[model samples]
Structure formats: structure tokens, C-alpha cells
Target: MGIKKEIEIRCHPLMSWDISNPILSLKSRTKEDLKLLSELSKQNNWEVDFAKELAMSYQTLVLTDLQQTILWVNAGFQTMTGYTADYALGKKPTFLQGEKTSEKVKSRIREKLSKGRRVSETITNYKKNGLAYDCLITIIPLLDSNQVITHYLALEREAA
Candidate 1:
């Protein structure tokens, strides 16, 4: 019998140089922008509204459970990942994590998430192009009644 062949797919990587965070580029207090994100998160159509206001050119990722189900994504997500909303929705954000990701860093994230607190850390992520980029990830634990973590919200920016 002939040998069978198998195929695998992967997330593509983004290639560029020296791009600062858009919030940092505004030349004003980024604290305000950061604060606004908190306020907007309470809104119903937060994903669409915030992406339009912030001019996000990449996907805005949100996880609705510790298992990392994608809860919300904006148009930028489609543009960056070359995947439509239907394909990306409900998928795990770890789709971005790969062989290049550091186990130590991932361990740290797991530790923090398990504690039910906001965690900020930078780690490597492979984009849809299979190119590597350093993503500054800020993960927030969303709490429900009685302060139980109902979800995790993640924001990412390219490293300076």
C-alpha cells in the first residue's frame, strides 16, 4: 500500500519594523485611552464600536471562558487573519500560540489566570503568515456576580 500523506495548517506571521502602539502614538495621556477601554467593555456592541474608534487594524481578541473561547472580534480580525467572522468565532485564541511561545511565559499566564486577576505579560505569537512577532498581551479577568471569573479579556500590541 502507498504511504498516506497528511497536511497541517498554521497561523501566519506579520513582518514589520519599529511600529509603536497606536495608543502611544497619540502624544497624549494614554491612561485616558486605557481607561476608556474599561468603560467601553460594558457596552453591548463594544467590539465594533471600539474597533472603529481605535482604528484597530488587527483582530481584537476576547475569551469568554478559561478555555479561551473567542467571544468577540472586530473587522480588523478578519483583515489580519484572512479569516471571516464565522471561521474565527468561538475558536480559541491559542490558535496564535505556537512552537515559538515560551513555556515559562505561558506558565506565568496560567498561574495568573487561575488566580482570577488581571495579568500583563509579553510573549511571542506567530501570525497567519507564519512570521513571528512579539505581542504585548494584557489579560484581564472579567468577574461576574460574587466575583467569580467569567471570562478573560485580552489586548495585544506589537512590541516597540
Candidate 2:
């Protein structure tokens, strides 16, 4: 399949953005306009109810760094682990990896991540209360413009 094509749009004031004058090229915009574009891309429809869609099911986590910091966690994390996002953030993700966690498994992950390769596996994790559960994991490295690895992106689901 071919790659998707992105449509380019020039956002401007209603007065200057005349549909009838399609042939006219718009003047360059200021840095402020670029910032506006960036903000628009990141905006979400806060009016939409996400909890309703989730129906109080499912868990999600965003893991990062070698320390495995819990950069972000959703409501599901609270439902599953009984820990709030406030408590999870800035802490090592391995807090969930308990005594039974295999050092071999952790080392395998370390090797792959150090080379900036993606890895998928099913491993054991613990809840705040010390209850253990299996989790299917996907780890992705977020790279900067220079292609250097920065943060790790981890998607986790209950192991079936």
C-alpha cells in the first residue's frame, strides 16, 4: 500500500483566506502562527467523555527512561493497581516488578533498549499490594531529531 498523503492547509483570518481567490499564495505567517498550529494539533475534545467509552475497563501505562519512570498512567491503572497517577509519576516503573521478577528478563530488555530496538514480551508485574499478574509488554524508544533515544514508550496489557 502507498503511504497516506497529508493535506496542507494555510490557516488565516477569514478576511485574508478567501476561497474565491484560490490562486493567490498567502503571505508567510509569524512564529506565533506556527505555535498556534502546534497547539491545535495537540488539542483534544474535552467535551467527549472518555470514561464512558472505557466503561470502567482496561488499563494503560506510559513508561519511560532506564529508571523506568511512570511518566503517565490512566484511570485504569488506578482501577488495577489502586495507585493514582499522582503517586505513579516520576517513580521507577520497576516498582511494579517484584521479587519474583527475573533478572534475566530484565537484562534481555536492557540489551534491546540500549540498542534502540523495540521489544515485545510477556512478563510478571506486581501491584502496590504485592499481588502479581502477567503483563504483555511493548517497548518503543522515542527518538529525537538526531535519532538518539530519549524516552521509552511502553504499552502494557494483561497477559491472556
Candidate 3:
């Protein structure tokens, strides 16, 4: 499919942004999703290009602030986790963890993230429906132009 070039101006309390025009024809995205992407790009001085690419390649995308508070999630996240963006927002990713989750793996991930490293792990994660599934997660520390870690981008998919 070809790319769709559309100009949309969305206003938020902090700022107003005109999305970079041509949005990829990967999937159906809501206006809030587009606005979140725009805000993330503007706030971090990063391009939304990578997000678009990742959206197509990954089943789920989770964006979290430095404190690990969830900032945004792509539509695939809801499909995969059975949790809406409204419910997931402001919550840490740990909320997905349950008794079946491994403490050792969690510790290792924490160690890597604390040092600003990228981590990949396959761990058991609980869905909103109380079912556990093996999930492969890749967490990358997002850096600003100043070379400081500002946020994290986690790409997740069910482990086969």
C-alpha cells in the first residue's frame, strides 16, 4: 500500500503539532495515537519514522518515561494484552507481571536498564484476563540529542 500524506493540527495543553504529514499505511490508528506520536517526537526531538517502522515490525510497542511510567502504547498493545491505553497509562509495566514472572529475569532487566543498556528477555507475562503467556520483550533506552537517557521503548511479542 502507498503512504498517505495528510496534514492534521492537534492542540494539547503543552503544545500544538502538525504531524509529519505522510503517515504510513501500516494499520488503523486513532487520533489520540497520532497525537501521542507527534508529542513524543516533538518533546524528544526525535523522528516518528522509527516508531512507524517499529509499529509495522512489532506486535506491541510501549513507551515509558524515565520513571518507567507508561506514557503511550500502540494499538497492537491492546490487542496483545487485552488492556486499553486508558487503563495502562500512568502505570508501570510491572503491572503486567504476576506470580509466574521470574524475579531473576526482572532483576537482570533492571540492572541493564539502570545502566542505560538495551535488554531482551522472554518472560511470562499475565494478561488482563489472568492468563499467562510467554512474551519476548526488547527494551531500548531512548536517548536525547544530548546523549541522555530520557525514556524507554519496549517492543513485545508473544514468544513462539
Candidate 4:
């Protein structure tokens, strides 16, 4: 089989992405993006050849720097949280926390972060409308080639 045939056989329907007009170009992507792309490609059977676009297409993806400053948020995040990327950028994830949010959960998350560990917590998060809802947040650490933590990929979903 040829290279084209190999790709055709390996590519899953969900992995199909238009490379013609990618959201973020491969050349312009940051080191973190490259690292994430490589990681995602290796872990999943799906062809993540267009990892940049796949990341953008994620329903609840929120990329943040090591300092926890928002770097990029996907459209799904905007629709779910009611905050545009422009408004969310450079802000901490704590911005979503409100009076109804759990203090114990916040402290646990902080502690886990200080230890540079992945955290999965279900807590109350308020939307822009001030309506509180339970959200399952999973923060994954993005590491560089040398294993230095560079960024975080926070996946959020409404808890049933």
C-alpha cells in the first residue's frame, strides 16, 4: 500500500480535518502547541495530523500558560461559558468561580497544582448569566521535551 492508502486506512471519521484553512497554522504554533499535537497524535488512534484544528474543535478546551493565564479557548467554551475568547484571554480560570463554588474543591485544586499534578474536580461554576451549574473540570499538564511543564489543557463539561 502507498502512503495515501495508509492514511486513508488510518484516518477515522472524527479525525478528518480540513488542512487547507487550519485555524492556527503549523508554522505559527507555539512550542506548547507542538508538544500537545505530538502527544495527542501518539495517544489516540485517530489521525491528529491536524492537531491544531482538532484542539480548536474540542468542545471544552481551554489552554493556559504555566501561570494559569488563559491563552486560547475553543468555540465550544465560548458557547458554554458565554465568554468570548477575547474576554477570556489572559484571565485566570478562577474568573468562572462564584459564591456557589466550593472552597474545599478550590483549595484541593490549588494544592494539586502546586504539586504539578493533574486534577479532576467537579465544582459549581457560574456562567455569565450568574446561573450556577456543576462542572467537571480536568486539568492536564502539558510538558515540554525535557519534561518541564509549559501549559495546561483544561477540559470542562457539565456534570450530570
Candidate 5:
């Protein structure tokens, strides 16, 4: 792997902080930013555009169909996983998994997905170059108006 890829995989932000006071970092929020955040807080999964915009931020976010096929991924995902959208789209997220990825974790994730429940777990995942790293992945089931699962939205951040 190149220096850029190694740096990308290792330099991701870790979720080991005490950020209970998130409002402390809102010192420069524009009116529009506040409005967007308010709107997102009220939205579930029906708002695709809003979700896409939210995913475009620093945290890695990915969307997959109910069948687990990748639909879209944010730029942050590309930076962190070393898989560009062109190569990642239309593939399953498991393409990033390797021998180090625990089968127990995969089974747990599948069980939660089958039950249409949100899953939060720290698991080993590989980058495009096959280098493994720990990620705290939160997968939220997206439901249609009739309460049927339509998709899944995954937010991933580095874990120790």
C-alpha cells in the first residue's frame, strides 16, 4: 500500500472522547446549518437527500439496499476505506471484510438486520488494500411508510 492509503486507514478519528457537551463546538454554526440540523433531527429514513447531505460530512456513512448491496457512500468512506465510489457501488460491504473479521460479529450484525433493529458494534474491517482496522459501525434500518424495511444506513467511525 502507498503512504496515502496507510495514513488514511490509521488517521481516522477515534470514538474515545467525552463529548457530552456537543453544543460547545457549535460556535460557528450558520443559520442554514442550524436549520439543516433541526430538519435532520426530525427526519427518520424517508428523506434520502437529507441523509446523503448528512453523510457528506467528516464521519464515514454508507447506504445499502435491504439486500445489503451498496448503493452510495460518502467521500469520508472513500478516504477511510480506500475504496472509491466507482469501485464500491453495486458491491456488498462485506467486500471489506477479511480473515480477521470475526464471524461472531458478522452473525450478530446479520441477526440484527434480520430483525430490522439497529446494530452497534466494534468489529475488524479491512480497507481496499486488505489492511485491517477496528471500526465502530452503527447500522440503522430504513423503513418505508408502511413499516417495511427499504434500506440500511451505516455510520462508521474508528474504534480503538
Candidate 6:
């Protein structure tokens, strides 16, 4: 006589199955990201799910008010900039700039943002530790149902 046994492992949709691995399954990650998007959408009154795909593509996802004050930042922002969300909140993105940053590029970015146009630029940004890194930034204006710009979303990745 022979007996056969099988074991099945089930994991919570919000958690990683591999306890030693920090990275989550794609499905779990998506669920978590959607939850965050839902909260942001509810709080800001904007449909932000459109950015779900972009949330993981960039190293940092920064949300700022129309006045350019930081509202939120994803975990990658802390990994890349050495600054926590608590420290970055309420601060202008310019706080990441340093003496080595380009004035011309800053002027161009300001002009584009003021015109409600999207801006994509590679610029120098300083980390909390005072180290400079080249970052590629893409800023898009977030609009409400009425098409009124209420916030800005910046996707940033460290330039190779």
C-alpha cells in the first residue's frame, strides 16, 4: 500500500510568500499599489490609477500640490534620495537642488510647469547626504474631472 500527500501554500495578497525575499509578487505589489492609488484619488479628488503602471517604473514617485509643495513620496524616493517622506513633505522640489544644479534647466522647468505643460529633463539633484546624482525627471500635471490642474506628479529615475 502507498500513500500520497501534497502540500499547498497560500499567501495573503498583500504579503510576499517568500519570507526571506523583500520583493513581492507582481500581483501582490499591484494590489498594494492600487490601494495607495485609491487613497490618493479619494484624498485629492483625482483619478490617479492612470499612474499605477508608472508607479513602479520610476525610482521615485513624487506628488506635489499646485504650489509645488511635496505631498507624498514613494519608498523609492527614500532609497534614491536618502530622505524620508516625513522630511520631504511640505518642502518644494527645489530643496533637492544644489549649487551644481543648472539654472537654465530650472528656468525651463519652471516655464513649462507654469504653462501646465509636461516637463522631462535630466538634471542634477542632491541627496540628503549631500551627494549629487543625475536624475531624469518627468513631471505631469494632474487634473480633476473638470480638467483643472490641481497637482503635479513627478516620476524620477537615476540617470546611468
* Number of the top TM-score candidate: 6
Candidate 5 residue lDDT tens string, 1-70: 5322322343223222313433332222223233433343344335344434444323466667777887
lDDT, candidate 4, residue 85?
Answer: 66
Q: What is the C-alpha lDDT of each candidate?
A: 0.55, 0.54, 0.71, 0.63, 0.64, 0.71
Per-residue error (Å), model 5, residue 23: 15
Query: What TM-score should be assigned to candidate 4?
Result: 0.65
Q: Candidate 5 — worst ten consecutive residues by lDDT sum?
A: 25-34
Candidate 4 segments whose C-alpha is farther than 4 A from its true place = 1-58
**CA lDDT, candidate 5, residue 113:** 88
Q: What's the best-to-worst order under lDDT?
A: 6, 3, 5, 4, 1, 2
Q: Report the lDDT tens digits of candidate 2 across residue range 46-80.
A: 12222232232224545455566655553345555
lDDT of 2: 0.54
**Per-residue C-alpha lDDT of model 4 across residues 1-160, encoded as one tens digit per residue:** 4322332232222112424533553233333344544544354322323454435323466777778887666445655777766777779988999988989999998899778788988989888888888988877776655566767777777776
Consecutive 10-residue window with the lowest summed lDDT within model 1: 1-10
Model number with the top lDDT: 6
- Colliding residue pairs in candidate 1: 11-127, 11-128, 12-127, 12-128, 12-129, 12-130, 13-127, 13-129, 13-130, 13-131
lDDT against true structure, model 5: 0.64
Error of 6 at 78 (Å): 0.9
Q: Higher lDDT: candidate 3 or 5?
A: 3
lDDT of 4 at 69: 87
Q: What is the clash tally of candidate 3?
A: 0
RMSD of each: 11.4, 16.4, 9.0, 11.5, 9.8, 11.7
Tell me the deviation in Å of residue 107 in model 3: 0.9
